[model samples]
Target: MNTSVVDCQKRLCPLRYLPRQPLSDPQASSQSASCVATSACESSALSFKRQAVRRSITPEFAKKVQSRSQVPVSRRSMRLQAIRPLRSLLHSKTTVSSALRPWGARGFASALVDKQVEGERITKVAELASEQAVRVTFEDGATAKFHKLWLRDHCRCEHCMHPETQQRQLDTASIPMDTPLHRLEVTDAGDAVAIDWDAPVRGTPCTASEFDAQWLRDHAYALEGGNAEDEDTAPYPKSYRQPRLTTQQLWAGADFQLPTHDYNKCVDNIEPLMRDLYTYGLVRVSDTPNSMEATEKFSKKIGFVLRTIYGTMWTTNPTNDAEGYNDTASTNLELLHHTDGTYIRDPPGLQIFNCAAQAGEGGESRYVDSFHVVETLRKENPEAFRVLSTTPLPYFTVDNDAHLATMEPLIRVDYAGNVVQFRHNDYDRAPLTHLSFEEVGEFYKVHRKLLEVLRRPETEFCMRLQVGDMMIVDNQRVMHGRHAFQGGDRALIGCYIGRTEYESRLRVLGII
Candidate 1:
């Protein structure tokens, strides 16, 4: 309602905004978000990459790189990315690198949130040993070191990246990993660097790439001298110099206020609601029409509802739907703190629940930020944390028509060891056959440990959802359930939204 999707996509689209490409399923967005996050992990991963380089380039460089290669292959093989441009300048008139311009776009919006503060331009270029990387220094003592293969892979020309889709066109694996640089120099204007490669990219002999100077500054991973693992990692930029949420507001019930907005007013704006939802994992809106129509309208303002076994729009009231729910959620039984769709590979990211009818007693809705819970587990019980994160468990839903199942760790984290998704639902669990005998015992032990942190009074928020009350929840990060109620009928109408769609709005608002 505040900013249209077209406006956001157009700003980033190299050409004109076109219809979004179709996704095969709801989880497609979640899968795609991982790829996007990995690509954007550049600036932060740089520090990690640099430490590996510093350790490997010993006085005995060749021997250490081989005999003493201690860095994990997973970390070493991670593609070091140049921060992507806000608007890919692939069509830029400059033809310096491989008939393409690289990571350039005037350093994003000149005054988005704040004036764009560009670092010093390229002052000098140095080719490090092993012919693996280049260090570009800036005028103001800032420096960025980039890998040779990474530079070739991220070239953003019409030949390398599709101009319309803004997706990579060049075959990354086909390119030589150690593509030697025939020549590398800072441009005369000091705003970009020009390079000529000795090996072919995707079998194309013409290997030349021009990288924007400001692009290098923002994306550059500065080298840090260290032979040991970093116990304390320095803070790194998360976006391409755009505004973003630096930290999630980990809270108990006391620190939150359920941000409320009337449905009528929300039609005019939804930014305030989104900001709160992203920070707190959930929020409540009042005075909404008690119908699925209103629920979907509110959902579409952010993104469309994800269709699943329960269909797009669903309800817990056994009286309302003829098909009837096959799950206990429709009954008057206390559901434990857990996420929905545990059987699906990528559980829904956001869940919208609009209470149409209320129960006179009990049936109070409950929520807990699993991110907060897991972080507590990390500190309070590091061993438990390791077990839950590394061990995989099976989840399943076997109905007459559908038999859905998947195996994954309960707490899914990213390369930086931050919680990305939480798939915890004891009720939906299948047999414990996925883990080894010893690991199975450990899983149960840690499961209890995690629940202890989860069920604490301060960590939970409980409220009886009332008529016209709507809740938006990050199902991936927040665990939600309800208490048993008897006397009055409790009905909740809701649907799910993918994580990809949720973060797209965050990007549009520059709040990622």
Candidate 2:
């Protein structure tokens, strides 16, 4: 390690002085690295290499330093002698350096051999030639590998990604399977890295991409070599993904509490409402203005109204005629606990139902926590749970206007082995011809077991929503049904909110 050349005194940035792994930036054209050559600490031994690295400091890193410190890089200091760092955002303590990934314009920092190291970050970046990827090592001895093609495909530069729309401009199909990287280094204060895509047989030439360290960590699929025993079995890898916000608080009849909200106050502040809805899978709002307008207003708080064949804002007013909407809910029939829209991919996240008019008797709402049922099944009947979780069932709805269909497992788990979604609807479950005869028998047995769980008295939360009450249900996590009705004009105003927009609202509100 060097003893004295590094100087981070005051009113200057020492970002360019630390040791590097022999790489230079082609972006910095205006500045010269010789500004500190006249300083007493300059050594003739490494003079040529030192100046070359300093001159290549990216402007983006300097801007970040200035913005973070809230200190203007004064004009008087740019032309002066020794360069020292004004520690504010970055660690302002004794440090050392290395050539990890491309630091924004930063040189790596280190602690003495005896003292414990702090602010540990990427300390080394190397190409894993055999793996066709690049590997980054953190100071704590952790390594993550990113395939070269994946890196090239995710370039977010202006040329690769559209600025306003934030969509990819490059064609993914044209990229080589094992993309070559002519250059790749950590950049942006070691927060991100720059990549230069080597000339390929299929894709664009000399493409450059910069990826954030955190992004790399989040999307890292494997280390230098993956473990065969620890192979991922989750259908979806959590690469920058966490499907559910919190562990589902599964409930039976005795343990459940139907969360209630004030419709008026929820309009002003929906955080508490959102918290309850996501935590318990459903929430009831008291004092709702029993009108379609009010229902639409309340539904928008969750997300835009999801348009379907049943219309954007639909009203379920049971009719005597058999030929009504394609849905069973359209008629006054005793509906069993089941999930809605199982026929559609990316089903609605939340379902809103406001009692605009209450029936005289019957038509009581029934809800069962699907997540809880699946968990119980997993514990009591492991084989049945496995069969249900692994088997795909088809659901379809054909109407005069539209035909919708989808095939998905009853229980879906993430790569982390956490249950992420539940899709169960026996009423909509079309046919079972796709499965083998033995598999079909198993599916039937497990499905019956699931029905038994659903039929348990402790599982269903029965309620008769009063006029002016609004109920918001987490469609993916809860199965909803209603008791048959015969008397009075019952009207329920409701709409579906797409899961995409529902999750987006949570993110924008910082609830997730």
The top-ranked prediction according to lDDT is 1
lDDT of every predicted structure (CA atoms): 0.65, 0.63
Per-residue error for 268 in candidate 2, Å, reads: 1.3
lDDT of 1 by residue, 333-362 (tens): 899888999999988989999999888788
lDDT tens per residue, model 2, 1-512: 11122222211223332111121331231132223322322233244233222322233432332233322222112312111221111222212211111222121121011011233346668898898878887545667877777777766454554322334567778887877777777763665577677653233332666665554654567654323234333345544243243444788865688989888778756767877877888899999998888889778766789998777998888652354676677778898888888999877888999998877879999999998898898889999888888898999988867888999998987755578788888788898879998998888898899889878998889999898888999999999999998788888889999987776555433344
Clashes of 1: 5
Top candidate, metric TM-score: 1
C-alpha TM-score for every candidate:
0.75, 0.68
**Cα error, candidate 1, residue 46 (Å):** 37
Q: What is the lDDT of candidate 1?
A: 0.65
